[model samples]
Target: MFKYLKNDLPASIVVFFVALPLCLGIALASGAPLFSGLIAGIVGGIVVGALSGSQIGVSGPAAGLAAIVLTAIGALGSYENFLVAVVLGGVIQVIFGVLKAGVIGYYFPSSVIKGMLTGIGIIIILKQIPHFFGYDADPEGDFAFTQVDGENTFSEILNSFKQISLGSTLVAVIGLAILILWEKVLSKKAKIFQLIQGPLVAVVFGIIFYIMFGSTDTFAIKTENLVSVPIPEDASSFLAQFSFPNFEVITRGDVLLTAFTIALVASLETLLCVEATDKLDPQKRVTPTNRELFAQGTGNIISGMIGGLPITQVIVRSSANIQSGGKTKMSAIIHGFFLLISVILIPRLLNKIPLSVLASILLLVGYKLAKPSTFKAMYAAGWKQFVPFIVTIVGIVMTDLLVGIGLGLGVGIVVILYKSYQNSHFLHIEDKSNGVHKIKMTLAEEVTFFNKGAILKELDSLPKDTHLTLDVRKTRYLDNDILEILDDFREKAKQRQIHITLLSERGEVENPDSYIEFFRLRPKTA
Candidate 1:
């Protein structure tokens, strides 16, 4: 791991810059203390990073959970009560890991996974636009389509132009340009560029720009527009930021319900990020999902114990790490240390860095994830893959992240059922017998109720004086629904003067009296 320090150290710094605004913004959005988010970020990085089996996955206070945290805080009556729920949620997640529920992450459709990453990428770009122009009504980390401030995403973008600050716009443009140059050109040209990422350079330039032209009224970027880290006045003030849980709320029904909700959501978000991060991993290293859950659980417990918000594996920081060439979990651990050190020793200095520069950094990350090439590539993979992928992207962009993924998963499941229905049976027409059609319907292995429609249709299409051979010889399991269909079809065949022959491993049974009885009487297979 130390060998990758040259890579991990720099990547950690980039992730640190990316994480700062998000930590504060998410806390503000959650209606929690601004420092709570920072605490979660710190614990996620240091604790989860240490325990997680994931090489590239980074944990933090997720924007995905902000709404839940916001609601739960109010619903539980106090933030202290909510902290109790967070701790319980952590315990629940540990149980989930123990039970190996993380295997569910493997079942997410590839198209949906790709769609989610693309959706998040798109969200990042759209969300950052207002910040890029220094319209700060919406915080830097809010990713919802409709803002809590009652402004919609497009409205904010349009408004940004009207409220654009000269200092922020200028700094953002320069910072973005520097990032692009460093990533696309300089990094390829030299190792130093790789060692010192573009995000760091952009941050330095933003600080310089803020100090230079920020005083002019026409160009000044206000304090509200910049990154706000709750600067602790002294040691006592810093200690006061940490909130202990109200253990009396532990037995409350609402608290338990909230705990379960947090566990379910946080675990799901973490699993999704684990899958996504592994896919984005250039080395293609698969993370141990169960271990990841355990790590996140531990982090959440610690975070809750100290007044921090819930933690999850975050795509934004995870992708930032990957993009910055992070080779190991060392980067995640180091980033946590940076958060601790910076907030403790140089928060005032951190407070000076402009939000526009951070927005520029995220813009680069977003572009890389939502590149036109990615869309084209998904489209090129064919409609089956592309449809869900596109739907997921659109869903996420238009709705919330989890809702969008649910939509994508719904589409994917429909596709699967459609394919299963189409593949249920094979049809072959041997109508060469002078006006008497001979249709051979071969059931697919493991035929289910989904195949009933196709079977019924095939039986209905049989012409008069036809010989129908319904073959299930290779089938292992035939659904009772199909048996009922076959029984009803036999009576119809009788009316049409069609001879029905049922063939299976048990040999031919022509015009059997009761299809259900015959199948039920047969010995059940293992």
Candidate 2:
């Protein structure tokens, strides 16, 4: 893990900066104590990173789970009670891993997965825009269209325009400039630049800018526009941040239901992230999905025990780590340590960092994920891949992560069914001989119910005095419904004066009396 210390160390710093605001913002979005998000981030980074098979994936409190956590907390009557649910959720996730439920991630279409990454990228860019101008009404982690602040995504953006902070905008502009320069020009030119990282410089610049102009009326960034880490004056106050689970309420039906919900959702999100992160990885390494779930479950268990929000493998931080050239899990572990140490030693210094600067960093990350080139590439993949991809982006931007994925998956399934329907068979009209139309219909390898419509249409349209050659030689699996359809077509053949010849691995049959019996007697294997 430490082999790539030079790369991982800098990447860890970048991830640390990226994760800090997100931890606070997600906790705020979830309506839990802000410190809880940091706890989850710490546990997720250290615990999950150590245990997981993934090299680049980062785990933390997720924006996708904010609404769920918020509602669960209210439904369970208290945050402490909700912690019990979280603990239960972790146990359920472990069971899921043991049951090998991670295979569910494999079922999603590649188009949908691509769409998910792209959609999230677009959302990040859009969400950060408001914060870029120092309008911090919505928490940075809230990706849903409807916000906890009673403003939808678009409305919040509109509101941001009305309340723009000049000072923050200026700092954001300079910070972004520094990032672009460092990444595009400086980093490539010098090893020192790569080791230092552009994000760190931008953040440092933001802090210095804040200190310089803090008292200026027009140029000063507002306290609300800055990172708001809870400052503890002493050890007792720091320890007071931790909240324990109300384990006595663990037996409640609501607690169990919430736990199951969190486990199922968190597991799903983690698996999806695993798939997406693997795709993004330049090294093309595949993480073990079952092991990932187990790691996440363990991390959640630890996090909940200390009053953390529900955790999942978060794409944003993971993507940041990858973009920053992190080569191993050490980056994630080190970032967790940074979080642990910073909160204890320099919470006040952290609070001085501007949100706009972080927003600028995320802006770049978003652009990389949702690059215009990606759009062209997706479109070039053709409509089967493109439709679902676009739908997913739209759904995610308009709603949330799971809903967007659901929409994309639904579209993907339809595309599969359509493709299956179209490709189920090949029909060729051979030249007529002896004034009789000779047609050859070749069934696909696997003929299921989806092909019924296409096959039935072709059969019904056959002309009178036709010689129909039904080829099933290459077919490996034939559904009973398709066999029944062929059987029903026999009557039409008789009425149309069509001669039927069945060709298969078995000897050819002329005008078979019972299609079903013929197939049943000569089993598919034979």
Q: What lDDT does the true structure give each of the candidates?
A: 0.91, 0.93
Give the C-alpha lDDT of model 1.
0.91
TM-score of candidate 2 to 2 decimals: 0.98
Q: Mind giving the per-residue lDDT tens digits that candidate 2 earns over 1-526?
A: 7789999999999999999999999999899999999999999999999999999999999999999998999999999999999999999899888888889999999999999999999999999999999899888898889876578988988988999999999989999999999998999897898889999999999999999996599887888899999998899999999999999998999999999999999999999999999999999999999999999999999999999999999999999999999999999999999999999999999999999999999999999889999889999999999999999999999999999999999999999999999999999999787889999999999999999999999999998999999998998888899999989889878988999999988868899998888878777375
How do the residues 416-479 of candidate 1 rate in per-residue lDDT, one tens digit apiece? 8889889999989977657888889898888899877777777787778988898888888889
lDDT of the structure predicted as candidate 2: 0.93
Q: What TM-score would you give candidate 1 relative to the actual structure?
A: 0.96
Each prediction's TM-score against the native?
0.96, 0.98
Model 1 worst lDDT run, 10 consecutive residues: 517-526
Clashing pairs in 1: none
Find the candidate with the highest TM-score and give its number: 2
Q: How big is the positional error of residue 506 in model 2, measured in Å on the Cα after superposition?
A: 1.7
User: Which candidate ranks first by lDDT, i.e. highest?
Assistant: 2
